[model samples]
Target chain A: MISQLFFLLLTSVAIYVFAKNLAKIRRNILLGKDIQLNDNKAKRWQTMIKVAFGQSKMAVRPVPFILHLIVYVGFVLINIEVLEILIDGLFGTHRVLSFLGPVYHMAIGFFEILAFGVLVACILFLARRYILKIARFQSPELSGKPNKDAATILLVEIILMAALLTMNAADQLLQSRGAEHYINAGAFPISSWLAAPLFVSFNNDTLVLIERASWWFHIIGIFAFMNYLPFSKHFHIIMAFPNTFYSNLKAKGELNNMASVTQEVKLMLDPTTSTPEGYAPPTSFGVKDVQDLTWKNLLDAYTCTECGRCTSSCPQNITGKLLSPRKIVMDVRDRLEEVGKNIDANNGSFADDGKNLHSYISEEELWACNTCNACVEACPININPMEIIVEMRRYKVMEQSSAPTSLNNMFNNLENNQAPWQFSPMDRANWTLEG
Target chain B: MSDFRVKTMAEVAASGEEAEILFWVGCAGSFDERAQKITKAIAKILHHAGIKFAILGTEEACTGDPAKRAGNEFLFQMMAMQNITTLNMYGIKKIVTGCPHCFNTLKNEYPELGGNYEVLHHTTLINQLLQTGKLSIRGGAFKGQRITYHDSCYLGRANDIYEAPREIIEKLDAALVEMKRSRTNGLCCGAGGAQMFKDAENGKKEVNLERADDMLETQPKVVAAACPFCMTMLRDGVKHHNKEHEIEVKDLAELVANAMEL
Candidate 1:
């Protein structure tokens, strides 16, 4: 009863802290401008299923696709056993669902197999990151904190799966000894084959103690991981679904037109038209900071797991340009988090810190982009770092009226003669005169 | 070259004749000396295919692709409206252009501003001609050559028109050697998003030069292009490696025209 009480207290505190941090993240994402991304409900759901659920985009990288599938499927399926643990923890019962008979044995057996797979997958993943040192994982953007956050999650999963298998091993041994509290509920297909022989000599009391210790450690690790999720890239396991749902549905080439600017331009075209009532000009152009972006952009930023797929596929980055799509996304989230904390500290109002997205993403990085959809195309969950880069470029050119000299010349000629160069308009048809 | 004159929309309208399509000869197609060769090739193919196409001539203005991409929305919309007014006045319905930038702007970007038309890149139209037997090829000079098609950003990834250009190359009796980065996975010629009109920001290697390397990797004897901007960039890229004399970067229209003996 005392142990059950302690379990309940620990579970409640972990869930409460996680929920609070999640709420703060939600608030930060909502700080951006409003845009309607929910236009097509049916299409959005289908997109979520295909891109997020099916992970169709990962097909490009076959190795990571298969390895990630093992970890993803095994880790998620094994968590079904956590429900049984939760019930057992709260009610102080051992294998409470053992009444399901063969069905319970089958599930426990499958979970054991999955737990083994999860442990192996995690070890391979750690090797890919730390041992083999894959180029995508070794980028400068994932230097300190991001690298630690990812490593910590994989290591924790290995430990958790080990505890689960160890718990099964000891419990099965206790059942064989016919210990008082031991239930012959689960079929330990994995642990029995691997760990049972070594533990066969242990006494029933020692077996009971080992099972209890493993059980407690396994459940406690789960609670700790639940909280760690809110602060780690592991959050992508949850965010990918919604991010894929609210995706860019138009042709990859078609940029979203600025409707406000179109209206003003229409008015400029016809001087006879009068301004409408409740009309206001925009105070600023494009995104200078996080608040100037759309909520969807913020969601995209948070959904990114720093996988570096976008960076690797980037034309500019591949050519050794200053732009890395991964860094652009991480910078957005970092700025959003900073602004979110500032608002929280100041009682729901932001205090200007003389910093914006421009502080992290350089003008050189912004200009280096080709506006190609490679990054948008490369992202498994469709995170659009290109959109953010375009928005920042809009801010620089329109708000600051600053651009490279050659581009300024192009803009001048476009204004004067309706072409990007200093050519005569009369010469537009000169080709018709030529061979 | 055949003494066949390209008609302006005004001349066609005055003569009580209507063209089947409006040839949107973009700024580069009109003014750039090198791109003008591509312009003439497209015209010759259309003329031989018996496709009655008319140009907007002096009436047509820029499509605002560079301005919009350079982050000048106000200027972009102004230019878009300017061209839309002229196009609508002529009651133009179907359009064809050799430049992918103009094709992208007219086909994808203009409809939202009430400038609706059936827009096709010149390669798509050429494919249509071949499919319908309007245009036939006998592989003139391009026969049995290993010609690699560099998918232009605007036409390939931008508008999903990869197969048309490749099909044209195949019809010319040429083996379509593909770059490692081809079709949807194609690399840019470092000339997209208004980069054509500006100096590239500081980088270890120029994008066009890297693309040139990708082209060279295929060991292609000829690099075929569809976009006028891509032609300039690829030509410069090929020249940078001193392979300009060895590899001819010809537009698909030029290849088709040469093959058809037009």
Candidate 2:
């Protein structure tokens, strides 16, 4: 009874803290220009399933992707056992769902196999990071906190799997001795053979103590991992679903038209049209900071898994340009978090920090993008870093008239002769006369 | 070029006749020396295919792709609205373009600004011609020669027109040698997003040089392209490697026109 009370208190606090963090994240994501993404509900759901749930785009690197698939499938299937653990924790019952009889036995046996696979996959991922030192993980963009966050998520999973196997091993020992409250209901395919060596010499009371401690450790570790997600790169595991669902459905080549600028341009064309009654001039053109971007861009930033596939395939990055697409998305998230915390400190309102996104991202980096959309294509989920680049360029050109010298020349020629060059529109048909 | 006469939209409208398609000869196609060759090849194809197409002539302005991409929305809108007015006046229902930038702008960007029409990139049209038997390809000089196609960012990754260009090459009886990065994974030609108009920002190497290396690995006799900007960049890329004399860069229209029995 005492253990059950302790378990309830721990579970409640973990869930409450996670729920609070999630609300803060939701608030941060919504701190952007509002645009409706609710159109084509059927198509959005299809994308969410195919991209987030099915893990379709994760197959670019065959070896790591296959290993990732194993961990993903194992983690998800093992959660069925987590539900059983949850119920047993609350009710102070041992294998409470053992009432399902052989079905329960088969299911627990399957979960043990999965837990072992998850252990192996997590170890390989750790080896990629710390041992083999994969280039993608070693890039400068992932140098400090991001690197540690990845290892933390992997290590936590490894320890949790270890705790699960140990608990099952000790439980099997208790079951053989006919200990009280030890239900010999579920099978242990993995712990029965694999973990038995460690517990062959344990007496009944010692085995019971080991089993109880392992159970408590496993459940507490899971709750801690759940709450740790929002602060880690592992947040992508949740954010990817919403991000893919609200995808930018336009062709990658199409730059979004500014409707406010459209009305102003029409007035420029005719000079006779009266402004509409509800006409409000745009405060600023393009995006200078996080709030200036669309909600979709914010969502894309949060959904970035910090995978360097985008950086690897980028033409500018490949040629050693200053721009890394992964870094662009990361900058947005970092700025958003800073703003969110600033708001928290100031009674739910932001105080000007004398900085914006450009403070972190440079003009040189912004200009380096070819806007190739290779980054968008390479992402496991549909995160668009190019859209942010385009928006920043809009701020640079229209808001500040700050295009590079050569592009200003092109713009000048575009204005004067209606072409990107200093050529005569009158002589457009000159190509026809050429032999 | 002297044997074939091109009709303007004004002439077609004044004659009380309707052409089936409008060929948007983009700024590069109009003024750039290399792009003019691709434009002429497309003109020859349409004329011999017995398709009635007219150019907007002086009435056609820039499609504002570069302006929009460079983040000048007002300037881009002005160009778009100007061209849209001219196209709307001619009652143009369908269009074809040799430059992927203009094709992307006219097809995708113009629709939301009240300019709507069926738009086709030149390669897509040429492939359609071959597939429908409206046109047939005779391999002629290009038969069995090793050729690789360089994907234009605006056409391949931008608009998903990878297969059309490849299919046209297959019709040329040329072996299509793919670079490790081709199609959706294709590298940019350093000409996209108005990068061609400006000097590239500081980097270890020019983007075109990187793309040039992708082409060099294939060791093809010819590098076929679809977009005018890509032709200019790929030509420059090959020249940078001093392989200009050895590796020939030909636009898809040029290849089809040179290989056609007509």
Highest DockQ model number: 2
- What's the CA RMSD for each of the models? 1.7, 1.3
The deviation in Å at residue B71 for candidate 2 is 0.8
Every model's DockQ, to 2 decimals? 0.76, 0.84
lDDT of 1 at A243: 96
Query: Model 2, range A1-435, lDDT digits (tens) per residue?
Result: 898899899989999999999999999989999998999999999999998999998876898888888888888888888898999999988999899999999998888888999899999999988999887777788988999999899999999999999999999888888899997888998998998778989888889889989998999999999999998889888898999999877788888889989998999999997899998877789999999999899988888889888998899988888899999999999999999999999999999999999898898988888888899889889999999999999999988888899999999999999999999889999888867
- By TM-score, the best candidate is 2
Deviation from native of the Cα of residue A388 in model 2, angstroms: 0.5
- Give one digit per residue, the lDDT tens place, for model 1 in B1-262: 4479899999999999999999999999989999999999999988888889899889888999999888899899999999999899889999999899899989888999989999999999999999999888864678889999999888877788889999988888888888888888888898999988878777788888999998998888889999899999999999999998899999999888777776
Q: Which 10 residues in a row give candidate 2 chain B its minimum summed lDDT? A: B135-144
